[model samples]
Target: MNAQAKPSLLAKFGDRYAVDPNKMFETLKATAFKQRDGSAPSNEQMMALLVVADQYRLNPFTREIYAFPDKQNGIVPVVGVDGWSRIINGHPEFDGMEFRYSDALVTPPGASAPSHEWVECVMYRKDRGRPIVVREYLDEVYRAPFKEGMKGPWQTHTKRFLRHKAMIQCARLAFGFVGIFDEDEAGRIAEQSERDMGAAQVVREQAKALPACPEEQIEKYAAVVESGQRPAEQIISMLQTRYELTPGQRSALLEVATTQGDQA
Candidate 1:
C-alpha cells in the first residue's frame, strides 16, 4: 500500500474539529463562491479558502467565517469577531490598531438622547504618513428615531457591537476585503430597521406571547441529530427547506442542537 500523504490544511482541520472538514469546507466554499459571482465553488475557490485559513487562522468547521443567506438563494460569507481580530492583529504591514468609545453619561447638546453611542478605530501603518481612522455610529446604522421600546444593538449590546461595527468598517478602510463584510452586522441593522423601524417592538411583543416548543419535538429533534445517521446539516437543511419555522422556533431548535451535541 502507498504511504498516506501528509494532510493539507483541510485534512488537518478534520482532526482539529469534530466536524467533517470536507463537508464543512464544501458547504462554505459553495456559499463563498456563490457570493463571489453566482457560480459554484471551483478547485481554485477551495484553494483560496485554504490560503485564507492559513492567513487568518480561521476554522471553517467552527464558523470563524460563515455563510449568511442573501437575496436569491445566494449567500454572503461573514467573518466573526474572532476572525476579524486575527486578521487585524496578524497583519505584518501594520503598526497595530486602536479603538475608543465615548463614555459620557449624557448625549451632547445636539446629539440623541441618553448618550453618544459610537466608536472610533484607527489603523496605524508604518508606511503611511498618517493612520486610517473610521468612526461609526449606532444611529447611522439603526435608523429608528431615538425612542423607548426599540430593539437594537444600542439597547442590547451597545458598547460591544459599537466597537465591533467600527472595527469591521475600519478593517474595510484599512485593507479592503472585497465582497467580504460582517454580514451579522448588516443583519442586526436589518432587524432593527424593518417595517419603518417598528419591527423590534412587534418582535419583542410576539416573542413574549409565544409559548415554548413541545417537549416531544425537542426530544425528537435532539435524538435524530445525536444519532449521527443524519449530519447536522441534513437536519438543518431539511427543516429550512421543508418547514417554515419562526425565528423563535429556529433559535429554540438551535439551542437544543447545541445542548445535545455537547452531551454527545
Candidate 2:
C-alpha cells in the first residue's frame, strides 16, 4: 500500500481553520494583506502568516491577525484590537481586568486633542492571584495625526487610545506575549525597517562606486585586522575612507578579526 500523501503547508493550515486553503489564501491576499507597495504576498510570506496564526489561534478571516510586508522580504505579524481582546481573554490564566483614569487632562503643543494625564490597567491572573498594574501616560504613548489638520483615531479618540495602550502594555507584562505587535507598533517598525533598508542600499551603491583597494595596501590592512587592536567596524571605516573593499576582502578581514582574539 502507498503511504498517505503529505499535506501542503496551505492544506494543513486550511485544515486547522476548517477552510479551503486555496480560497482562504486568495481571500487573505485580497482582504487582509494589502501591502503598502501594492505587491502580492509571496507563498513563503503566506506560510509564515499561517504559522503565526496557528501559533496564536487567531482567525484571519475575522481580521484577528494580519501582516505587512517588511524589509528583507519578510512579514511583520500585526494583531488587531479584536485579536488582542481574544488573546487576553482566551488565555487560560487570565481572570479579569480593570482600568483607572487620571483626573487631569493636558494637550501637548501642536496636538489637536487634549488627552488624560494617564490611564492605568490592572490585570488579574488565575494562577498568580495578584493584579499586574501598568500605567500608560497619554503624552508618552500618544501618536499625532500623520498630516497637519488631519484627525486620526489618536486625535479623535484620545482617551480610548490611552486605555488601549495601557491594556496592551499590561497584557505584555502579564502574559509575556512576544513576536507580535499591534497595528501602531507594527507600522512604526515597518517604517523604520524600510528606512534602514533604504540606507543600506544607498551605502551598498556608494561602496560599489568607490575605486578598488590598491593591492600594495592589502598586507598592511590584513595585519591591522588580524592584530585585534581596534574594532573591526572602525578599521573598515578607516579603509573605506580611501578605497573600496570587495565582499571577499571584507569577509576575510572580519574572519581574521574574530579569530585572532586576545592572543593577537
Candidate 3:
C-alpha cells in the first residue's frame, strides 16, 4: 500500500468544494464578472462562505466575517487574515452581500410551515472561477436586519442568555428522570422534620391532612407557581388524578403541603 499522506483542510473538504467545469461555464454565462472594478461581492459569494464556515463549526463572528464577498469575480473567495482584518478594522466596507430565494423549488404540501426558507447549493460565479455554495449568501441576507445588534460583545450575551434558559429547563426536566416519590411519604417526612423543630401540633395535623397529587401535575404546578400564578386549580387537578382523593383528601393535602412549605 502507498504511504498515507497528511490531510490538509482542503483535502478534508475534498469533493464538497470540487466544481463541475460544465456547471461553472454555464454560471459564468448567466452573470457578469465585476470583481476588479472595486464593486462589492455578490450575495451568492457571501452565502457560499457562510455555508462552508457553518460546516466547519467555526465561531459565529468568524462565520459572519466570511459573509463579506470579494468583488473581483463574484466569487467571494476566502481572503486570509489580511482581507479579514481589513473588514474588521473598518478599512474597507464589505458591501453588496444580499440574500435571495427561488420559488421554483417545492416540498410536499404541509410538510413544514409555509415560509420562504433558504436552501443550500453550490453556485458557480464566472468571475470567481470556483463554485461557492449559495446558502451562505442567503444567511447574510437574513442577518442584515440584526447587524446593528451584532457589533462588539452583544452576541456573546445573547448566546449566554439562551444557554442559561436551556440549562434551567434541563434541570427542571431532570426531576422527572428519577423514580416518582410518594406524596404520603413526603408528607410524613415533612411532618417529622417540622416536629423536630418543635413546631405546633397543628402543623403536624395540617401535614396529615394534605392531598396527594400526581408527579406530572406537581411539575406543572411548580411551573405555574414560578410564573407567579396561583396554581390552586392545577393542584386540585393533580390531587384528583394522582390520589383519586375526595375533597377531604385535598383539604388534608393542603394542610400538609403548608406544613411542608414551613419546613422548607
Number of the top candidate by lDDT? 2
Query: 115, model 1: CA deviation in Å?
Result: 4.1
Where does candidate 3 stray beyond 4 Å?
Answer: 1-3, 6-8, 11-14, 17-66, 69-264
Off by over 4 Å in 2: 1-13, 36-38, 109-112, 201-264
Please give each candidate's TM-score: 0.49, 0.71, 0.15
Worst 10 residues of 1 by lDDT: 104-113
Q: Please state every model's RMSD to the true fold in angstroms.
A: 21.4, 7.0, 24.5
lDDT of 3 at 104: 40
lDDT tens digits by residue: candidate 1, 81-130: 88788777777767888987777543332333454467799998777889
Candidate 1 wrongly placed segments (more than 4 Å): 1-57, 102-117, 143-154, 185-264
RMSD of 2: 7.0
**Candidate 3 per-residue lDDT over residues 1-264, each given as its tens digit:** 989986543343332346453443233223322233445345465345434543433332332223222222333323223332233233132222222444543222222222233433332333444433334222222212224434322133323222222322222232221211122222334445656556566666666766555556555555554454554555666555435455654564455556555676
Instruction: Compare the candidates by TM-score and give the number of the best one.
Output: 2
